[model samples]
Target: MTTVHERARPAAEVLEWGRATVDPAMREAVGALPDPVRHIAGYHFGWWDATGQPSEPTGKALRPTLTLLACQAVGGDVEAAVPAAVAVELVHDFSLLHDDVMDGDRTRRHRPTAWTVFGTGPAILTGDVLLTLAVELVAAAGPHARILTSAVLDLLGGQNADTSFEQRDDVTLSECVAMAVGKTGALLRVSCTLGALAGGATPDQVARLGLFGEHLGLAFQHVDDLLGIWGDPAATGKPVHSDLLNRKKSLPVVAALTSGTPAGDELASFYFAQPEFDPARAAALVEQAGGRDWSRERAAQLLRQALDTLNVAAPDTTATGELTALARMAVDRTH
Candidate 1:
């Protein structure tokens, strides 16, 4: 049994490689920006110190690792997938910046969020710049161009759906699944598709890989929901019960509320009433509703489904071993 810490070590190394590619590309892009725009973008990507000179810490770069691993799983050179990997990660970061603003989240990865440090206007522009960078990088990938554009469209659609669900009282599980597929799953699916595209995989092979990534992404979200409730603050780099405080409509909360337990009823009633976000009350609600356990079970099932699909997609056991390891690590992650 690989511990989450153990799994994260290698993923960290993978992230470093992706990070190496980003800074140089960012340098090229930043030079093209006007002075004030340049400063904001530089700070956002961690290329500048608070005083605004060169420094570093471009964040975890997890999505890029997924992109590279998908490429390798299809026997493509990881180097060939660098453009796509960078694009995906930049897109992910863009979402994170905007999400922080919308959620009123002041921090991320233990540092002030872009919007918190820069003003909301600058942070919004910074996110827009990153989105443009993603598009430009993806466009540079030539033959796989469509994958990038499609991912962008899907990402926007997902974000819209996620916001729409927040106000509605009657969101179903299936609807949530669709939203997840678009929001979280879309880029993940594209990572695999980009890999196949880079590797010159057959059309059928590309389709299967997309399906594999989609399932893995669904499982990833399930696990994330679990951690948001139960994960330790030290390990996760956020306050415990951050999602509860945010009133995020994640998988576990949805499942528990709909499951018909006494705890569930209490939760649903509390949620409908829109009680103030008290950390103690939120934690109690999660415990009472068995949200954590329900979410863990769902994550396990989705992981199994993902593995089953991978078996069909890449029959060569040796070829897919790394990717299989990554899939297991994703669902089993604590943070």
Candidate 2:
């Protein structure tokens, strides 16, 4: 619900600080890679174009911000947790590169995907290098190294389920929810736990922070599902009707299908009968089945749960307040 004129937000300052601190280290990490791989990584980060021209950064770096916020929530200096933040961001980018490749997506971050520009083989290799680098970064963070690897396994499991869902019409809401947790929640959970650990939080605090992140991650994905079905391509930085074109069983779509309404029945017929989806008609069907409203309410519910969980963990502080506001914004985001 934020507009351009809403200059400062609860999490804006901390998130901005995180993006500033992490970018330099993130760039250096990418720079450390070998030639062609480094070049591809640079391009993916929007640091340089195919011809070495400078460009803009790709995303909001939300995962890194969450890491830094977790640090502050536990009384650690943001600078001290910079490496952990960078690690989370690196893994996120690694996932994005591989996701684009796997989904055959042409664009990301408002630019042609690396796989499209550098060829799929090179892009996948570059993603592999990034994943290795991410592990190395976390290994430097100490005993928590196992956590990052575990999260990666969960992330891959989620993505594997997602791809499988594409070929089947019998996908259940529970399966989709689990897939979302594995794909999206696992990393966010890792980010918060790693940050809390680096911040010297106790085991109890760290585990609680991770739980808060898991709820936030679920809310984040529900909003993402909303965006996929109804978001503007220019704002979302993707093609129009991107999910429907791929027949992605986003939560809203799942909700509509299981609503048992006539519109839901009609939508199912369209999904099964058509060779290619018509974005306009499909969108209309989803709306008719109350998909958008259902998704919005679900996101709000998850956001509330995240805030409640966060409260049980940390004391009332400016840092935790900002985190609460951020959890709210995560669900309300349009893109």
Give the alpha carbon lDDT tens digit for every residue of 219-282 in model 1. Answer: 8888877788778888898788877877777877777677678877778777756767566676
Worst 10 residues of 1 by lDDT: 3-12
Best by lDDT: 2
What TM-scores do the predictions have? Answer: 0.86, 0.92
Candidate 1 wrong stretches, greater than 4 Å: 1-9, 21-34, 53-56, 277-290, 315-319
Error of 2 at 27 (Å): 2.6
- Residue-wise lDDT of candidate 2 within 61-157, one digit each (tens)? 7888888888878888877778888998889989999999887878787789999999999999999998989989889868778999999999999
Q: What's every prediction's RMSD, in angstroms? A: 3.8, 3.6
RMSD of 1: 3.8
